[model samples]
Target chain A: MIGWTRRNAGDQSNSEAVIQLTNVDYTYQAGSPFAATALHDINIRIRKGTLVGIAGGTGSGKSTLLQLLNGLLLPTGGAVKVLDHTLLPNMQKPRLNALRRRIGLSFQFPEQHLFEDTVEKDLMFGPMNFGSSRKEAQSKAVEALKSMGLDEALLKRHPLTLSGGQMRKVAIASVLAAGPEIVMLDEPTATLDSAARRELIALLARLCREEGRTILMVTHRIEELMEVADEWIVMHEGRAVFQGDADELADRSEELDHWGVAVPEQLRCWAEWTARLPQLAALPLPRTAEDMARRIEEAVHGFEKCESTNIASKEGSQQESAQELNDQADSSMDAPYRHEKEVSACVTS
Target chain B: MRDKLIIGRMIPTGSRVHGLDPRSKITAMLLFTAALILSNGWPQLAALTILSILVLTATKIPAKTYLRALRPLRWLMLFVFLFQLIAGAGNGTVNLAAADPLLWSGTWGPFTLTSAVLSSALLAVSRMALLIVFTAMLTFTTTPSMLSRGVEGMLKPLSRKGTGAERFSLMMRLALRFIPALLEEAQTILKAQAARGADYEEMKLKEKARLLLSLLVPVTVGAFRRAEELTTSLEARGYRIGAPRTAYRQLIWRSADTWFTLLFALLPVGALLMRLTV
Candidate 1:
């Protein structure tokens, strides 16, 4: 076990862990009638400036883990250290307030928290509470709204008047106004249309890439985060079952699917194709459509050499088999070509 | 139908009353209730009534909305008025002497209205109305969470005695939030029962009582399940009962709160002096 731990610790010098859960165990009130253990002996570390995706089924304790990051819930049996604050079962009031200011949490279906009359006041609530002046808070609200790709005209409008997608953005902008170093969201894209979901993911990606903020989001849809997330954490029945880089996750796609999380269909198809062509399997698995296209081009070139070898070895029977293999390749190429063209259009236009 | 409840509806006006620290509002409410109790005559009651109405108007919520809020109490108000009119007692009546020319007209019954009973009933109804309107004003402007926090803040000075005030308020807020959701669930259960040969509206009184009792079992079981899930979610978010934490929305006392307090305080004292002089 020690050797495996040492072997796994490779090239972690550039990144620093922002949240560390050390042997954390939590059980609901023990003497109560409905008492049950929610999490047990959990240890995980989330690094700074990375988008970490946590995937789990219902009642798998994914929600329980997110609460521990901001000291919203305490561990019953162990310790949780978030940044500079160490949270024990008994925490002082002052320390808890300090911890909350450093971490911004957006609860599930966050639009419920929009209780202010106008978008500006709702966004300003957090910053003002944390001791920002009126002017500074208003500026932060504007900045946060802009980050969500919302218009300045929305500031005076009631939050309830906005459309569903806009309401979700304003809810997020309220959290951003607090200016926390780390932002955690619970199912941010749940119930959104595909276009809105894509825009939200892109916005989160920018926060991590451009603003240098650490983001930890819980998502049942693992495929949604495939292109943007740098790290993957899989939870099952209150345990951190797997934690590693995105590439490491690609190899464990089958295990993930069995755990009730759907891996992207594109990745699965590419994996199956690579399995039949052993020479192509040597290359790294691609995370996006463009990456898949480049890999396929290389694979087709490799296939030409194999075809030539087969023709040289068996000149008599090569024509019929070669034609059939070519036909299969042609069909596969056609679908991917159209997909690439659509993606490029989206990117450019 | 469930959405019509005035308890958790937060009107997002940024008026001074809306922004005043919840602790101040709670204190002011107690003080206002005490003054209403001390008020005796028309002069004092009129002052208190006018003050409440002015505050209500200043909230800038629609007049129609305020009247609509009173709709729930309409039946109860009529009951009180009818009870007062019929059941009231008065002084003894005097019969006229027909032979004496100097004798005037006689009072036939003791049922005639008198200052004592009439004044008491009128004052009681006015006090009740004032209390409801003022309390509604507080809830109308503030979120349920803020109200709970305000209650917690007011109780903070005594928290050393293990009251768990903050946790209790948090529970109240959660309960208020889930009331509508629970009512919807109960309605669905009622509909399901009706679909399966249980006609609640057509049933006799005894049968209706039995059917309602049967509905309680499922509703209670559903409520417990929800409470369990809510507890887990809250606990996971680092909520500790009895642990002190800084408020996200701090209540600060402004000049308006102080001025409002002074104005209410002077009314009862001035009324007492006026009654003594008269």
Candidate 2:
């Protein structure tokens, strides 16, 4: 029953706050001479079932923020609320094992932590720690493995023997086996091939969408999560400078560089398109290349139609020429798959 | 854990001690150790302690930093003190009726206490404290590479060829450099495992052992991976074993370094002189 939260009809304000940090300041080795403030005055509220991408440069307190949420580290100042528990500066932490079970944190290069003799055992370690029976843990292990899009046969192999990608997946699956409501991964896609990274992100997005688990992921590269991240938290030098959806992120794309964050190509392309055609901003920001391309084509077609109408009114004799130009525009329409290259060109231009 | 380790760390105050040639510092450390071992009486101990304090003051680092370095060894120091005290008190082989008479003798409960036993114990504890503080000073003043280079320089005469000394010094340098890196990696792994609910502090002894067992593979693998990367980098930079390499920053033995070594040489000589007079 620990870490369990039941919905109350009367309470609505903080009900959606799966993880909330209010004026949270974290200093490593606080009170010691070597004390360093890793995070400063950070305030972020992540709602339930939302896939939040936490992006920051190196040492921007992204990893520290994840640790704070899980009670691995108590803040030197302010409070960190994850699920039903609240962690204050010097409070006797609520049963951390219980809190950790509810909020699974997978650190950067998590594959390096995989140490069990076999992959199944490694996956079971988390569930067993949370008081699950051996059989229950085994079943959970299989479920977790399957959820990560890994083969069931891989459960019997030694974790060290697995391919790097497989090992990374198994390592992530171990945390998933604990059945945490809030799964926080720190740079899960790092050191992974592009295809593998995409697959992993898709799987994580599915976990958030299908299971309604709040997924807080930390990444230096925001491009990987641009499509799926329901919310984006941009950390700038230990501060949560921005926390909003894709559109809001698009609006503030200019500031990403000042924050030491590389503005994703998608965001840059969107900014360019929005700049050229101001009315395109009215619609929801396209999350995928195909969607963006389609939107762009539609906008271009609308512009052409307006141009042709104007020409027909002013110069009725050149109506055929306008029709010919419209046909040419239709033929010149590039396929959606080529949008990424075209967008990059547009951004560069 | 990383913060606890003061050895292999250099806190530069830009003082004379920091500027002293590492070779002279290493020589001074050996001389101090010899003096510390030779000193048996109160006067000798007091002299050494004062000398150490003076040298420590010259370093310009906070006194508390050295005390913090000693923090981890508190229990060991206590254990040594008690062991020496009990052994000295219980020794029946001591000729108490001879030259030195007991300053005081008493009994409380079942255990006997004597001034001779107490003094000897205090001496042993003081020696240990001084030794630790002095060793810490050498490390604190000299960077790991400089220490290794000084060691290599000293070992040059003993080697049949330069290769043996060069290889050993390189090994020393690598170890000094990597100890902190390895500790940091271990800490990270420990934190990662803790996040998975294997909180080492909360775990029982058996569970703790099991968790440590689990950590061994990853840490070892990480070390090997790092070693491989390091070798590749070294080779990439055209470094070769036993190759005649010139120092980028050559060790300059100033008149100050000679004077520094000579000052340390006096400690053991003074201790020996005092012993002869007694």
Candidate 3:
């Protein structure tokens, strides 16, 4: 249910760094009347085969940063090196094209790009562009569609006729059709219903975990990505405000709002819990609902055992009502959990 | 590419031109165009040019902003100039049989050019440049809502003919409003193509055309979706084309607006006066 797992079956890409940026700067419409600098002196290294979440407010250069990852946007300053290809200011187009083929980029609402008559043609479009044979491209399309949890029968139907959720999946599948090593998506879950959002997240997770692909997603809401992401990059006012793991991100939750990003709900709730229950302050951060609930269960169990010891030595009257209270609490807390997070404080304790 | 589009975009300078009634601006624009057409010779053009400068100064917007509005029309203006030069139109003396003793003659595969052609080209370019500047001033000063309202106000007389002027104006408004949004989507799709290894910069002429044509479906799809949403929103808000409605922001014409209107009214009248006499 969680994201990161080292792939051993095949295609275990051993590269330490998949994408690198050195002193990168980008300015929109440079040397024009309305030229505006989007990024400056930006340095970033995205680890291979990890789900990296890029968070920023609107116009925070998150999208600009995505363009520079491949050669979609040549850096106005410095260089962007993707794999063995270095995107210098005067880099050749053939080299850039080669580099871009290794990284798949999906714009927000990529479904809007599905222009072919049928889903099959749309899926085959990318692979065919990369010089795949018709037969190979056809097979790749089917495989991509299947990987995205879409029915193979959808290949014949017009993409516009599909339901919104299905269309979104197909759009993502088309990006995957080309078989790129890294997939960078901009606001992938935007406008999706909560269920669809979760499904998309799961599909992206599967891409990273199962297929061993590197994913860099640009999303304003951090909660959904925080769960699956191995690393987080926060952008504010054209610069990296913070770049770290989830724990560090959680620590920065209080200041995130000032920087114009939503603080993760779990982090906010966890903050309240720590403020109320100071004894549990030393506990590790929870990534999911189950993790938090399990931690609470442990804390309650600890408090109960202490109560039992006091009760055994002194009185029995208070024990019955407290036990009744415990039972009521347990009954109320009993609900089906996704069991997403593997780390549980209760087990470790 | 989008940075150059200033037609639908309004720069809020809080100037007197911006504060004027939309009706007044619309009237002035009509008068200006009539004056431009009526005024033919150098003296009339010089008078109109001076009048334009006066109006331009009154607006207080930077000259560069006005020039930016002409940026998109540069190629069109050039084409018009070239067409006037080659097609032997305007100023009878521009013909091959001409009078003023050719300053320079050059052959380019088929056609010959002379001083008469150059003079006529100058005339066309000047006229075009003036029209672009004046038109740009109107959009730069007025916001899109005012523009839509101004158009509707101009079309008020045709309402009796049952041509659905309101609906037509609304359509125009929507088109103007979505230009930037559509451009943004286009930029995004291009980025997506690059990610797919389309290599837009390195693409051949045929490849680029194919890529653009491929996006036509999604762009149309997106437009339809937006139109649907807009319909729902309008319906929800009780919007009807022919319904009687109170003015949300009433257009009020002040004495200053009248004065501006009167000042611009001089263009056509003065041009006629110049044509009759000088």
Model 3 lDDT on a 0 to 1 scale: 0.77
lDDT of each: 0.70, 0.83, 0.77
How do all the candidates rank in terms of lDDT, highest first? 2, 3, 1
Best candidate according to lDDT: 2
Task: Find the 10 residues in a row with the least total lDDT in model 1 chain A.
Answer: A1-10
After superposition, the stretches of candidate 3 with alpha carbons farther than 4 Å from their true spots are A3-15, A22-41, A74-79, A85-95, A276-279, A303-349, B89-111, B157-165, B276-278
TM values, all candidates:
0.51, 0.90, 0.84
Candidate 1 residue spans exceeding 4 A from truth: A1-13, A92-94, A309-349, B1-278
Window of ten residues with lowest summed lDDT in model 2 chain A? A1-10
The DockQ of each candidate is 0.02, 0.73, 0.50
For model 1, what is the error of residue B12's alpha carbon versus the real structure, in angstroms, after optimal superposition?
Answer: 43
In model 3, the Cα lDDT at residue A98 comes to 66
lDDT of candidate 3 over B1-278, digit per residue (tens): 47677666676778888899988988898899888887766666788788888878878877877787888999998998888877853444323234345677787878877776776677667878898898888888898878888888778897886647788878888888788778887777777765665656778899988888776777777778888998999999999888887778988889998998998898899888866774
Task: Report residue B103 deviation for candidate 3 (angstroms).
Answer: 5.4
Residue A166, model 1, lDDT: 97
Candidate 2 residue B74 Cα shift, in angstroms, is: 0.9
Candidate 1 local lDDT, A15-79, one digit each (tens): 78889888988776443222578888888888787778988888888877877776656788688
